[model samples]
Target: MNEIVRIDNLSFRYMQGLDNALEKVNLGFEKGAVIGITGPAGAGKSTLLSCINGVIPHYMNGDLQGHVLVNNQEVANLTFGQLAPIVGTVFQDVDFQTVSITVEEEVAFGPENIAIDPAEIENRIIHALESTHITTLRRRAISTLSGGQKQRVAIAAVLSTLPDLLLLDEPTSELDPIGTQEVFEAIFELNKTLGMTVIIVSQKVENLIDCDRIIVLSDGKVAFDGQPRKVFMRSQRLAEVGIAIPEVTAFIIALHKKLGQPISTERLPLSIGEAQTTLENILRQYGVLS
Candidate 1:
């Protein structure tokens, strides 16, 4: 019942373009849920986030139909100043959102712009730096941070606003594996401790294995939307559309096939750790070993 964002009959087209960037999309997100959005290029994933965060009709030149609501308030009805506290977005390019030279300053920028009390702004900056595990880097110049660190800094900057929903646009796409892990750890940790709802767009399927839900868009429409397991159960369907289910999920499916029975999607593992536990249990259940 605590839905944070809702989209109703939404559709949009660039002012000069011929096709709708999004088409009649209807979706809802619950508070504290970590949902992953995935699909091919130009599939409206970013556009969807833009709508919820008031970037579509308010800032961008687009023909938008329908509406997006954040915390039951229409996004388009709210001013940018009003929406900043309800939703925060981190785009693929961290530089766009990060303006200050130092990590601490970057984190403080959002609250400062909103004219929060100085004491409250300082407290929010401290909380954000700690939440993102970048306390040691607080005074470090933004130019010296690695891609991962920079992304974390950007996230902390957004967190400073204490938004209810966080919109991530491929924040980890350009990071190395370790960097990717670092960013996800910070994000999921914040999601756990702060009870923040997150909507992340990524083509990195495996990383999304832990998401509560995966929504796949194809050609500006909702082609698949369900729990991770339920959506990945359509592995073949995903592959046909140039999307690969996680390698771990594929291995589990193959193992089930080798046993002459299909494993229930409910029992499949989306991650390597889960796969190990599942396989061990299966061997023990079949009396293969102690």
Candidate 2:
């Protein structure tokens, strides 16, 4: 698999402070994989995402060390104008990213700023709107949309530039359940169909249950990096770092301990359907179901 992002001994510290915000972090993300970053509030999750887009040392005053490479180019050496095309960022607050009144113009803003041809910008606007399933709202004012709709517009805006890697900071934080599902579905489609590499920093682990991998951060360092199942099964460690597993996975663990069943934590289920299947199998073995 092609590497989309690579971090080597990356460390950063606020100029006004004495402690490091990120310390000696090392990781690699491949194309077409959905990776999740989770930790406590002060664990530097957002700072890590910002580094991918060159926001740390570029937009903010900070002391930085090590390297963050996107598409094999170091972020520290790239300008926002040069990085915009390859790495698109969706901030936690969608309202902060909006720049146009209508959805169509908002989606076209980035391409326009980059001097893309008018015809090509129009084509990209339509494609992004359709990709995000917000084509019907293209003509609507940005203020009139709900929180979820606003976030969809923000994503469409980024997609208009056709970025190879997407860095999302809690994209579904403010959406309702239905809206959250819509956003996740769109992300899933992009990863599976368009082969877009995604790295999301989120507090809600339930939304990341299907991610290809999960990375847990604590005290500005990587605590765990592995498959979702492995991370979820390490409930004690996750809790220690202020991270939570999917509720269904927690339920399965509780049930297994209470029933004294030979439940393998390695195959822990992340979704309700998988949990149901596991429960049924356990019941059958106990002669409660046949």
Candidate 3:
């Protein structure tokens, strides 16, 4: 896979702060991969996302150092107009990304602003709404939608721009369990079907179960970056940094301790079905279950 985004020796400090929000960060994301960014509060996950979208030095005043490259172009040097085509960001709060009242208008807003051909705008709007599974809500008022519906609409709005990379900040933070699942399902489809590079900053570990890799941040630096299973295996290290593994992984860990089993933590499962299968096999072998 080609590198869709890169961060090299990146550092940023807010106007009121002396310490950098990000420090010497280095990372790369592959095209068509879903990468999850997680850490304790104020660990610079949001800052890093902003850097990728060129919002830090351009929209917000701050001291910034290092390079953020989207599609091999430096983000700091790119104008908002220039970055719009390559990177689209859906904020944690959907309200911030909303511009029009109706769902169709909101999805068409970005393409319209860029002066895309009217026919192309219609096609993009239809494609985005269909991609996000919000086609039925095209003419509905944005205010009438639920939080999850609003989130889907927000994502659809960004997709309408046909960005190569999508950045989501706590995309499911305001959602219920079902809502979260709906959003994740939509995200999975987007990544698998559209081959869009996805970078998501989220605290919800379960939502990241399907991510190709999970990058854990701490003190504005890269602490862990690898497969989700590998990262979840370090439950202790993650806890020390105020991050939690998926519920199923946590359950297996506790079961292993209670049953005195020597299960490999490194092989911890991410989903409930996997955990159940593993547990059943172990229990049957030990004659605990027939």
Candidate 4:
């Protein structure tokens, strides 16, 4: 598959820093894929997303090397306004995202800013709300919505611009369980159904279990980059880098050690239902259950 976003030998340092915030970080992302980025604090995760949005070398001066490409266009060469149509970045705080008083007005803001035709803007508003599963919240006051609803509103606002790529930094960090679930559901719909490419930066590993790929950064370098199961399989290495495996995966790993079963790492569970099935099979094998 062609890479929608590609980084090659990318290294950078803020003007005041001695070390690069990102070092030799070569990576690629596919269209319509949900890619998760996670790592310890100060691992340069946020810095990476900033590059794509033309924040580095523009507003923030830095020594840099190599390059980043979004939609095959060199990111550094593009101005922020130039990149706005191609990329949309949503931050963790919904408060910063909500400019309009109501959901419909907020969703319409992106397209309106670009001076989209009036009828077209209306259609985009409708599509964005429906895609995010927030059509019912369309006329509701932004202040009246829950945190999860507000987050979805932020996403819908970005979606109205019809950007080629979506960057979410800690989109669900401040959310409760239900809020988190709601955001992921919208993410899945955008990727799985609407074929939108999304990259999420978050430390919450459990929420990323369903992602197509996960990349772990450490000290400005890639420590792990693979599908969730394989990366989480090396729980010890992850822990060394101050990253944690999902709770269910950790449980299965511990169970294998305690039972001396020598289970395959790939057999470890990522979800609770998978854990249940795996546990039952182990019980049967041990004659502990019929």
Say which candidate scores most in TM-score: 2
TM-score for candidate 1: 0.93
- Clash count, predicted structure 3: 0
TM-score of 3: 0.93
lDDT values for all models = 0.88, 0.88, 0.88, 0.87
User: Ten residues in a row with the worst lDDT in model 4?
Assistant: 174-183
> On residues 1-290, what C-alpha lDDT tens digit does candidate 3 reach at each position?
58998889998999998899999999999999999999989999998998999888898988898888888889888899998888899987789779899999999999987789999999999888876778899999999999888988998898888788999999877777876787778777888888988998898888787899999999999999999988888899999999989888899988888878756745687899999988898789899999
CA shift of 109, model 1, Å? 0.6
Supply the global lDDT for candidate 4: 0.87
TM-score of candidate 4 relative to the true fold: 0.90
Off by over 4 Å in 2: none
Error of 4 at 198 (Å): 1.2
Tell me the deviation in Å of residue 123 in model 4.
Answer: 3.3
What's the number of clashes in each of the models? 0, 0, 0, 0
TM-score, model 2 to reference: 0.94
